[model samples]
Target: MITAENLTKRYGKTLAVDALSFSAPRGAITAFLGPNGAGKSTTMRMVMGLDRPSRGSALIDGKRVQDLPAVPRTVGAMLEMGNHQPRMSARAYLGWQAHSARLPRTRVSEVLELTGLASAARRQVGSFSLGMRQRLGIASALLGDPENLILDEPINGLDPQGVLWVRSLLTHLAAQGRTIFISSHLLAEVEAVADRIVVIGRGRLITECSMAELRERAGTRATIVSTPDAKKLVRVLREDGAQVESELSAQEVVRVFDRSASQVGEMAAEHSLRLHGLLQEKVTLEQAFMELTAGAVEFRDGGQEPSATAVPSAMSDGDPQ
Candidate 1:
């Protein structure tokens, strides 16, 4: 397991990382998420022993990374895919890493095939696209077949097919009981693959929990009701101690926050009102993230605030897609 115990970092007078504490457990994929300048890179650097922490420690299996024996065999990290020798071929790069780690030379080819880089093994590092470079970096990390993998934005630049491939690869790795901790800004992709998420903002930890737990804690679920007597239903729902809002397009619809579809349906039925539709709208990961990090945002444009927008409502034309 990877553990951060009150990990803090300071660059001159600026506190880059606050006293953050969390764990990336084994046999699961944990996604690290944060806004710009939220100190995600700094934390990852500390974990890899690339940067000295101002206070506290980052430990793997109860030992600091610098103190670990055979670091490559214990943990593999890929922070920057672009930081590589330009003239080296993909195969040569992995071969060098394998040699340095005292790993079998054959392992280089194994990782190449594992990362789908066997076809382009002979390609020059300088000539490969960003996506291919990412694959090469991953191949190097996996060359040692370490039990833990720490990757920062492993899908920075990739087409749809490449994205899917990376997702499948990470999921498969986690299924093999390897500890996979990744940092990404792609929330949609993260939601699809990550079993747990750690979110930080402004150098402070905001939340860390499973995706399902985070959604449940978001505390934002609404019942969307479509009926001909929208105004009457809205009044009735409010009178029943439910907060409601209305939206009128071609058809009449109302949103009852903190209420379930079943409750709304029963209430409408008791009132003898005909209902066209009823949907229980739950908070998505994107919505939960936006709400959680709203106050922690260190930088913002001169645009509307996050709180200004309502939970995306279902259109009266049809249920939410």
Candidate 2:
């Protein structure tokens, strides 16, 4: 397991990470999430021992990363993808890395194939596309055959097929009891694979919980009803303590918040209302993420503050830091 206990980092007077703490457990994929400039990279650097933490500690299996007997074999990290030599072939790069880490030369070929870069292994790094470079980076990370992996934006320059392949690979790795911790801006993909999430804002821990718990606590489930008597149904739902919004378009759809489809249907029946259709709208992961980090956004489009009501009480990890 990878654990951070009150991890903090500072650059002169600027505080990059502040009293942050979270865990990425084995056999599960944990997503590290935050808005831009929220200190996610800094925190990850501290965890990997690339940067010294000003306070607290980051541990891997109860020991510091630097203290590991074989650091590369214990934790393989891909913090960035552009650090490789441009003039070197992909195969040559992996071979050099494996040699430095005292790994078998055959392991280099294995990872090249595993990351789907075997066909491009002979190509120079400068001649490869962004997607190919990404694959090469992943191959380098897997070259050590580490038990834990930490990746930052592993899908930054991939096409749809590449993205799907990465999703499958991460899932397969986690199923083998390897700890996978990744930071990415793609909430849709994160939602699809993450078993839990650790969200931070302004370098502070906002919340950390299972995906199921996040949905149960902060997800908004709304009921959508299509009815000819939209006005009447809106009034009925409002009187029943449900927040209702009616769209008086050709379809005459009404959205009722904090109510289930069955509840809305029973209410409509009680009011003798004619309904064309009723369905429940499950809140997307993006919606929950926005609400949880509304107040923590470092930048705004129009220099406007976020709505106070945008953050729900249940979503708050604790009293604001």
TM-scores for every predicted model: 0.88, 0.89
Candidate 2 ranges beyond 4 A from true positions: 229-232, 269-276, 303-321
TM-score of 2: 0.89
The candidate 1 region of ten consecutive residues with least summed lDDT is 312-321
Off by over 4 Å in 1: 228-232, 271-273, 303-321
Task: Assess the local accuracy of residue 144 in candidate 2 as a C-alpha lDDT between 0 and 100.
Answer: 80
Whole-model lDDT values for every prediction? 0.83, 0.86
Best by lDDT: 2
Error of 2 at 48 (Å): 1.0
Our tally of clashes for model 1 stands at 0
lDDT for model 1 comes to 0.83
lDDT of 2 by residue, 1-321 (tens): 899999988776667788999999999999999876678877887888888999999998788999999988899998866799999999999999999999999998899899888888888999999988888888888888899999998888999999999999999999999999998889999999899999998778999999999988965677899999999999988887889888999999999888989899998899899999998888778998898887687657998764442222111121111
Give the candidate number with the greatest TM-score: 2
